[model samples]
Target: MLQIFSVTFPFFALVLCGYLAARRRMLPLEAIPGLNGFVLFFALPCMLYRFGASTPIAQLLDYSVFLVWMFCGLVMVGFTIAVTLNDRIRWNDASFGALVAAFPNTGFMGVPLLVALLGPLAAAPIIVGMLVDMVITTSLCIALSRLDGADKHGMAVALKNALRGMLTNPMPWAILLGGLASYVQLELPGPVHKTVGLLADAASPVALFTIGAVLARSQILTVESKHAPIPLRDYVPVAVFKLLLHPLLVLLVGVGAVQLGVPLSRFALTVMVLAAALPSASNVSLLAERFGADNGRIARIILVSTAVAFLSFSGAVGLMT
Candidate 1:
């Protein structure tokens, strides 16, 4: 455990530093988006591309890992909505809540951190899980959120918008282009590849720091606003589901699939389980707010899950390793 914490603590501490910086106005809230843009558009995509280019196309699209993670994610989405939905919380809030429960912060946090913990081989499963979350799970949850509206075409419209959003996202495209480059044995010019590597190298620390800044900005906004106190039922259960139950569910289902003769790698299963254990994606709050859902509930769940993940994630790493 001490050895694991030695690895994990610095990552969490970077997060704490960003949180404190934003909280103390050392990093102004307005500047958070610039950080987010740099990481998302410039840094993270390059990192994914670098890893993806090196990884074989087969590993990147490992159907066994992809299917297993996708199935488990759907179950979480449904289970969370079932448990949290009520008269007050309708489809908009409930579905976004389910989203946060099921959608781990894999793109920004998991790709770099899991690879750091489990080595380069871990990138394939982590990317597979990220693809599943971004392509399938996210679209489904967004579509479900539209069920609250009277618009007859709400689901279809939401699904279209979600797919469009995914298309605009550079990460998947980077992975895809990298996979193609890998598949065809293509090489970039020396300078171009070097530039990509430079950006890729900046990804882990910068992305992790950006996560903390975003979370801190959210926390600050949440505290300053005069909204009704969010009930524990609104957030805690979802956070618990994200940090504890989601990973357990992934592990159990992954093990079952292996027992059932699925050609799943134990290493991939371990990666998927850890991916499931990550905190809720911070972007979900923005999604909720945009779609007229309860961003407050989404924010609370994200905050709680991220705060708890330090202990739970390290513990899982300790136990799994």
Candidate 2:
């Protein structure tokens, strides 16, 4: 566990640099979107392409565990709706609430931490999990946010919109293309591989820094002083769902996998649990803004849950590892 700590600490430190830089105005909030674009569209995709393509297909197939994790996410979504169904917070806010409750910071936080602790083998499961997340969790949040408006589109339109969003997402596309390339045995030449590697190396540092910048610029805390109720109560259930229930569910699944003879290593299991315990994606707040939901509360949840997740992740490592 202590050895794991040695590896994990540097990742958190990068997050801290981003947080502190933004908090101190060393990087303006306005720069975050562009930074995000670069990470999402370029760095992450390149990294995914390079790594995902190289991983063996048979190793990537963790059908039982994947099903379990997806089930956990679905259960959390249902749980969120039940908890947030009140006049105090509308249904639209509930959708964002569900998203906050269910979506882990699997991209920025999950990938780097996994790579650091578990080595290259962790790439396959993380990529698989990410595909599940983007296709399901993200789509639901967007569709639900639209429910609060008068523009009631049909189910087909909502489905189409969600599919489009997923299809066009550069990060997912990169992973998909990389997987195809790997499957087809399309190896890149040495110089191109080196170039992609260089860009990929920049991903973790840049992403963490951008998260800090986004958090710094977030308006969540400021809404507290306003006359509106600010959805304080809504945060309670969502945070509990994320920081406490989510990890427990993952742990249970891991234990079951162990019992059923799943071939995951200690390191791989550790990555899965840690990824599960991470806070809601920092992107959720931006997503809330895009869909006309409660952005401020979403931001606060991201910040608070991130702080909680550090402890949660460390504790999980101590107990499981």
lDDT of 2: 0.76
Candidate 1 lDDT score at position 67:
87
lDDT (Cα, 0-100) at 90 in candidate 2: 77
lDDT digits (tens) for residues 75-162 of candidate 1: 9999999988899999989999999999999887888888889999999898888888888988998888888783467788888889
Residue 212 C-alpha lDDT in model 1: 85
Off by over 4 Å in 1: 150-153
- lDDT by residue (1-321, candidate 2, tens digit) is 678678767767777788787677687766777988998888888888887888876656667546766777888777887778687677777888888888888888788887776678888878777877888778876776666562366445666877887888888888878888877889889999898999889888888777766776775234433635554575765877898888788778777877888765565566667677777888878767766676777777887787676667767667765
Question: TM-scores for all candidates?
Answer: 0.97, 0.89
Off by over 4 Å in 2: 148-157, 220-232, 257-269
Scored against the true structure, residue 135 in model 1 reaches a CA lDDT of 87
RMSD (Cα, Å) for all candidates, in order, is: 1.4, 2.7
Q: What TM-score, to 2 decimals, does candidate 2 have?
A: 0.89
Model 2: worst 10 consecutive residues (lDDT sum):
219-228
